[model samples]
Target chain A: MSRSDNAFNQYLDLVRDNAAVMAKGRPALLEAVNKAGASRLAEAIEAYKPASDEIPECRLDRLFAPDYGVNIARVPMTADVAASFRCGVPQLNSLLAVVANDIFRPTDVLMRNMPEGLTVCSLRQVPAEFEADAAALLADGADKNSIAGAISDALAHDGIYVRVAPRTEIEKAVQIVNIFNSPVPMLTPRRLLVHACEGSKVKILLCDHTQTPAVQHLNLQNVYIRVDAGAEVEFYDIEESSAATHRLFSFRAVQHSDSRLTVNTDFLSGGVTRNEFDISVPGDGAYTSLSGLAIVSDEQICSDSVVLRHLGSHCTSRQIFKNALFDKGRGAFGGRIVVDEAARFTDAAQTNRNILESPSARMEASPQLEIYCDEVKCSHGATTGQLDERALFYMQARGIPRDEAKRMLTQAFMVDVIDNISFEVLRQRLHILVEKRLSGASADCSTCATACHSQAPEE
Target chain B: MEDLLKVENLRAGIDGKEILRGINLTVRPGEVHAIMGPNGSGKSTLSGVLAGDPRFTVLGGSATLAGVDLLGLSPEDRSHEGLFLSFQYPVEIPGVTMVNFMRAAINAKRKYLGLEPMSAADFLKTMRQKRAVVELDNKLASRSVNEGFSGGEKKRNEIFQMAMLEPRVAILDETDSGLDIDALRIVAGGVNKLKTDQNATIVITHYQRLLDYIKPDFVHILYKGRIVHTGGPELALELEEKGYDWIKQEVDNEQI
Candidate 1:
């Protein structure tokens, strides 16, 4: 057999060898994992090709190899540990009240930072009131087709589940911190389930970070959200890992009637980052807005795949994704919107814009719309180009240096995404972080601890 | 008194095609010189070459502002050395607020001059004082630079920026191209208010409408990349009355 075949077999063998340890006493989940793994083992090598036409350049096997030995280490989450982490980043102290926080490791989940009005615990130990609903949601959305999906599904037996009370509004946002620090090659699997009951409102922030740049690893995450009738939910996910780490983040959310849902993803730094979003509006009068920004450089790659479905009448969805690439960086965006025959008066629009700062930098964008109804409004557009040289010269002629002019233009390109955010403090904090990233500041967790301290905004 | 701006045998072009050929000009402090010519006569090229636009290369020439070598410095450095160009078409920069853009420009110049940066209060006060010269609205000052601005508003903004920087040599390149009579009057009035014995101005135009508002000490007629005549402000009116056919005929015959 060839080298890649051998690696694939070795990966399968590792998954089989650690079945019991990774399963965490969930028999049904293990059965599902084994079934999915067996089906994949039976398919031809061509099965490893990219799953979508928009991702022709993708090599799925190389991008995702759980060959990192499956090693599970547990660390308790205490007040001191949480406080130290919070104190390291000064902006976080003033920006986030952190109503609920949880940290996930390679194969373990630790939940210690818990404020009032939030129920944070392992999926296996959910309270009796929310236990049945959480399990049903997970079983319905579980990945049952691909190798990585099967592996993550099995590891998700030890995932975190949160529930926001019905008819209530959360005063502060909930923070979910996922930290991956491993000495050996490992695959960290994280699963999060959030259920907002009827007439409830909540905002969530998820951050992915690596402790060091020494270890090579992959973070596979699955997020499932249910927004009930008349509810409003906002989810923001930010990824700032080291260059040695790869990330496959997925989010699937369903909305009921008269609900509003918004999801924003910011990919600042990573080795190879792919974010998948699937939002479904099944009830009439529901609205969804999805926005994302990615900055890639130095052989890094970041792609976002989004699918929005309108199934009920008068539902609306809007999506905008922007990417800035420099120094051989690569980026791709695939956005698709579907409106059913019964979903009359549906309004949907998708826009993807990119800037390539270097000759070697590349980007691909594909926006598609499928409408089976007569009275629906749908539009999509994609553009890829370099920065406006005229604008740069204009700024320089006004006494601004060329480098500063470029930075200002780049930052300006990303302001619309940040402007859509409803939180004032969060918007201000993101502006600073984006400026720092554009200036080539250190984005690793360790450097962030010290860099953010000195760069904090003065009162 | 020393010449504020001296251009000697300056030749430049874009993409290897020479535009400004054997051009010579001099402007003493407190003097306003107007360069008038028909279309494609290199009126704007001189302003671009002096402002150090990379597109138009300096084939063989020398330009000095305030006794400083202008050709050797970058565009920002030239601006810091007291040179400004009011573009015919002002660029629209989205997402960059006027406040931030002006602050960055002012601070960069200050750093080049070895002076401390301006305080927020001081900068705002300065902005307010200069904004009135052109009747710029308070809302426009907080928005992005020239984004979604009308033609008249953009012209007014250019003069406001000129007033803020207070350049020693200001080159207005067709600033009155898209302006109405009222806007032309306001912009020219602002330039006149900012004039001083320590600075000079160059007004490049195709018509004498702007010259009517801002009187010039001397008028130069540029033809075929060369200045064919130099006279007083009446020269603009004469060219307006006789048209460029007479001058073009005379220059073409001389070249033959």
Candidate 2:
């Protein structure tokens, strides 16, 4: 075996052993633990050490510190509640749907009218179909020693696996809805694996939401995507957790030859959110685009960190992240792009723009590029400023109220990102969601637009 | 006829330095009053003070618009009360389309007047009609407000906005500063078309060239922060031929 493989096995063994000990007293979580073959993941809970310098000081240490004393309970999903969730996605016959309720339990998985040979199953059920492939894909790629990864493995209950057959094209997007209905603070970890085979095409929308604002939970999610040769994958990650919840999201993607991958992360609301992205182009002629939009206010904090690497010749990658901050909100964007020596003729660019509405709002942006190849072109830029005073006065001179003018300008700043969405209905829905979030209104569901009301004028 | 605007002994300045020192002017309905002056003669300052710009402090003044006290109103409130100021340098607002900006302004005025927002069809119809007044490109109208527009296009956009708002008293501040012949003609034509028997205009310019297009009924030559000479259209031709040196000489002689 390769040296890296050997190290990976050792890390897995350590996590499994630690998890085995931690799972001894928790009879409720044992079945999922045994099914995942992840005793080592439990072991990682205690053995993991965080790199303090790499992470910002945001009370993340206390946030990630494990609390194992809480009891695990399943929130029952009634048929009515399930039906309400269906309204989030458009009525399409070709959609593959998966619904997970609080505590990372898959309440429903339906593959209706999907292309022949496509496989969609839970992680526990993956062994019944493609045992070897599922095991290798799940156990690989992610750094098992990181605190976020270790905690996700230790508390993971359920996950979904989607495989698109070679040469097949799915016209409709796959929808995954995570509904958080916990009445108390709980730690829920979930996993997702998407494999777009050679020459296949697929689109996925993963939405995380809460049933009520009263729920306080820690949601840990790890997503892995592999795009094969000549395949195309479009992924949208929408996080609209309640103000009381903290979300830690880690995403990793690998692109093969001639493959195209586009990933957009939209952070509408959360208490303390951290998103990490690692995208690698390992084959020639591959292309990747990573974009993010975050609107945070009222002391909320959102951070996005990305690492994009081009390891093959003739590859291209681009990234743009924007944040709109209001009140005492804080935001950070850290992005790095690397082009290896062999990755000649590579083109990469990264840009981050932030706008602050209040004097107390804060933003930090770091964009870096590392190019070892001689024939590669790469650039990065960042900008942080307040709303244009001239623009504000211009609008005000046209009879728009000061408050309304501010709102209009803020909405205009997000048009570049919102216009990138190809779907018409989804784009309009996102417009409403962004407007509500900017006005400091909390939305109940990320996917449902009707639940939010327009902010009333201050009397 | 009742005066559309009345300024009595207006004394205003910026940073405690007097600019408009005890100036007075009046405009009755259907009158086009041109305030021509040399540079630093407080021509633009007069327009700014009248528009209720917060940068300037009114030490002593009583300016009334349509029998209402204009000094107590905000800039937007003044706009709602049938007052408009065509900025000398229109500010560029990125990401705000001209359509949205115009709509917001129209609706704000409408709301203040206790009227419903204009229907989308009517709004678009009005936009098309007014856009033709200045010959503004359809593409430019849909783009961000004044963003990346040329000097002439920005001036044209300002006039187009005036046509849409249809204010009772319009103040054009240096409207002919950077315009070619064709653009100047189009802007002047739009202003003339919007003129009505119940409305008036204040044209503040340094040159008499703009007077050739929009014929002014009264020409007031302001020198040293006050109106030194008021005359007919013949005075503009005389000033253009003899130059502002003659006016400054005349004002200096009067001061002595």
Best by TM-score: 1
Q: State, as a TM-score between 0 and 1, how close model 2 is to the true structure.
A: 0.88
Q: Cα lDDT of model 1 overall?
A: 0.80
The TM-scores, one per candidate, come to 0.91, 0.88
Please give the TM-score that candidate 1 achieves against the real structure. Answer: 0.91
Q: What is the lDDT, from 0 to 100, of the residue A379 in candidate 1?
A: 89
DockQ of 1: 0.88
What residue runs in model 2 are displaced by over 4 Å at the alpha carbon?
Answer: A1-59, A65-80, A88-98, A102-109, A439-442, A446-459, B9-18, B54-62, B250-256
Model 1 C-alpha lDDT per residue in residues A1-459, reported as the tens digit of each score:
465654355545555666666455543533453445445554533255456554432445665544675443223333323333453443443223221112432211123444445665666566777767776777656654555565565444356776777877775566666665556666666778888889988888877766646788777788889999998999988888888888877789999999999999998898888788888888999999999999899988898989898998998888889999999899989898989898999989899999999999999898888889999999899999988998998899999999899889999999999898886666776788888889889786544322322112233
DockQ of 2: 0.65
Interface RMSD of predicted model 1:
0.6
Q: List the residue pairs that clash in candidate 1.
A: A68-A185
TM-score of the first chain of model 2: 0.84
